[model samples]
Target chain A: MIEEGAGQVDGTIRAVLRDVLGLTQDRVNAFDESTPLFGLLPELDSMAVAGVLTELEDRLGITIEDDEVDGEMLETFGKLAHFLRKKALL
Target chain B: MLRFGPQDGPVVIAAPALFEEANRTRAFLVRILRLLGVHGIAGALPDLPGQGESLLPTHQATLAGWRDAFATAARHVSAVATVSIRGGALVDGPAPVSALWRLSPITGAEQVKELWRIRQAAHDRPKLRYDPARFIAELDVEVAGNRLAPGLLAAMNIAEPSSDAPVRTVRLDTNPRPADLKLPGRPLWRASEPDVDEPLAQALADDIAAWVHACVA
Candidate 1:
């Protein structure tokens, strides 16, 4: 059950990135823990960052405070999923 | 006003999403209106006060003004139903339509919060808190590129979609909110640029057409 919940959070994060950034499913599916986001992805600009965060909150049924958002959380796909896991799973 | 289909049939007055989402979803909404035309439903997309082609300055637009303007447009067209997207749902409540079809409708408070989030992102400061009291107390505030009246923002912060008329809510499959139907589509409103999802538009058009027919029957 725990594993399934964690996977769902990760999948939701991947889907949010794909939908908000207008990325193809294959591109998002290829992302792994080390995949760099934020400044690395051209589509993930500051404006897109707000969209991604809001979409994540909506999908995950969690409210991400403005203060909780930081470059570190969005630094990598893994980090984002990790943050989501902490918020969603707990 | 952009009119589609026959001039005399049951008409659908469309209220496009507000602010930046309006730009992002304009093409998609237009496509839906066009598809609705093909389905034999008359559609009208009007420019509300301070939006689209309206001459009113953005900072001068209040929530009440948008509602009144939408109601006036509906009156002119004799619309039977309203098709509202996102924040547009808030504006269509006062329209004299018997039925309302909303696509991913959001409350005014939610819209204001999203605007603040976008503003914070533009400033590249993630730690900026959204203080609603302080925000509405200020003068005209610039959110994204639009200078919005504080009164409008304050009104939006407490406004809910009007439930006086029969409302059919449709949301995307990714959204867990309760909806009459959840369609499979990415949110065009969140896209970086204006994009058209023809399949989504087609789906929505078909749904709207059927809903309007039922309402008018």
Candidate 2:
């Protein structure tokens, strides 16, 4: 089971965003639980979400379902990290 | 004549994705592999049934058919492994190739989403009227640029291929690498300018070549 506060997940999420979504380093690093994703980030539009998810799954060896994602899951960096940790447990 | 390296050296079947991606990366990838002493085949698949000069329409194309085309390309060049970029990774390599190299593989669903975005971009122009939500529900409509048959879309909406071949992935900027090889630059391929960063390309080529050598050795 993955720990909740583990920093690596956050870093991974940030990296995926930068690499796949083309978010600037400053934009990615500034993200927190309140940063809001999905509808918030211009780069995180519906199309970019697929690439980001695919990158996470391939690199992290996690499986994500289309139905599993919603605004809450991607609400912020912390939320996204939390979601990944939960997925890792399952 | 396009092939590089000795007649029997290891060859990587270069399978690039559609449209702009193919235009940007195909030949460059092949050239890099050739420089690294492995023969790379860039023209690995025939045009989709309805795409290019083919008499069929895009709707006639299937993922399985494209796989067959990729297999034929593999057989044609006796490829030992496949080098797939972006959506190209969706094509399953035949059993002859023992390893698969995927670079930032994209999902079919994502491809559809991108197509939707492209359609949205043409809002200023008079284009066909179609809603992606309705199209996806029907599961046989064409969107973006390619024909998305149900089976093809199903096969494409995956991060990994169904092949038993061992897979190695190279994430451009995310994966940790030696400081010298780290991709510090943005993925310019996504921008409207769509320029290739030679340093990044060279770094990726080097990494791939090393992996191929290790696999074949």
Candidate 3:
């Protein structure tokens, strides 16, 4: 399993955010892990969430179950990274 | 006689589906094109409006509109074949297609059932149980939102083989691409292993390369 705090994890996550979701760097950095992502990002909705998840799945070779996450998990970057690390994305 | 130009290779065009499937698979599509190029297949995947980098058109394009893009692409590439997965089969005409390769083609109500079940599996996280009947009900709505008209919805139903067109299907095989992997949202270990063997991928690329080389020559 990949441990947390790997140097590239953060960059990979941020790249996934900007390139996959088409979000700006400032916008990605603006929100901490605790912020509500779906509503805050506006660009993120049910469909976008699925798209983003799909992009993450393909790029990272991870399996994100719809059942595993929720609106809260999506609320912040820290939370999502935690979920990823928990699932071993990091 | 077919012309052999740098860009004159088979073209791959796909239909627009809702949300993540399209985006996640975008890189995979481009990669396939590049691989085809290495094999002398040099293909092009045109952007359909409202999906990919294509401008988001407000007026929802119908099935025919999307098919027109494939026809347009086919016109440019003479000695060509077409490849598509899922909704892609719906586009363009017979495609003069040398081969119709769909990574995973949905051809029946079972596909509809599976789509809902998969998304519900993703949505109902903690529970982690698949409810087939309920999932199917939800899928109707999920797929419904993507299309604007009823006729188009029926038309987009990729299950109908006759509906896709009169093209000959060389190998209707389904091989999951890296596009099918589950990643960042979940974790690498949690995702399924790559479908084709690494050697197979290299070989598939090589095989196509030989064919394209022969055809181009």
TM-score top scorer: 1
lDDT of 3: 0.48
User: What CAPRI grade goes to candidate 2?
Assistant: incorrect
Scored against the native two-chain complex, candidate 2 gets a DockQ of: 0.08
Tell me the spans in candidate 3 whose CA falls farther than 4 Å from its real position. Answer: A1-7, A29-31, B1-79, B83-96, B99-216
Q: Each prediction's Cα RMSD?
A: 1.1, 7.3, 10.1
lDDT by residue (tens digit), candidate 2, B41-94: 222333434444457667777767777877776787777778777677777565
Better of 1 and 3 by lDDT: 1
Query: Per-residue lDDT for A73 in model 1?
Result: 88
Chain A TM-score for candidate 1 is: 0.96
Q: Write the per-residue lDDT of candidate 3 for residues B122-188, one digit (tens) a residue.
A: 5543534444444433323434234233334444544343334323322212112433221122211
Q: Score the docking of each candidate (DockQ).
A: 0.82, 0.08, 0.06
lDDT by residue (tens digit), candidate 1, A46-68: 89988988898888899988888
Tell me the TM-score of each prediction against the true structure: 0.98, 0.58, 0.46
Q: Model 3 over residues A6-71: C-alpha lDDT tens digits?
A: 434555567567654566688776756676676777666554565466555544557776566677
- Local accuracy by lDDT, each model: 0.90, 0.62, 0.48
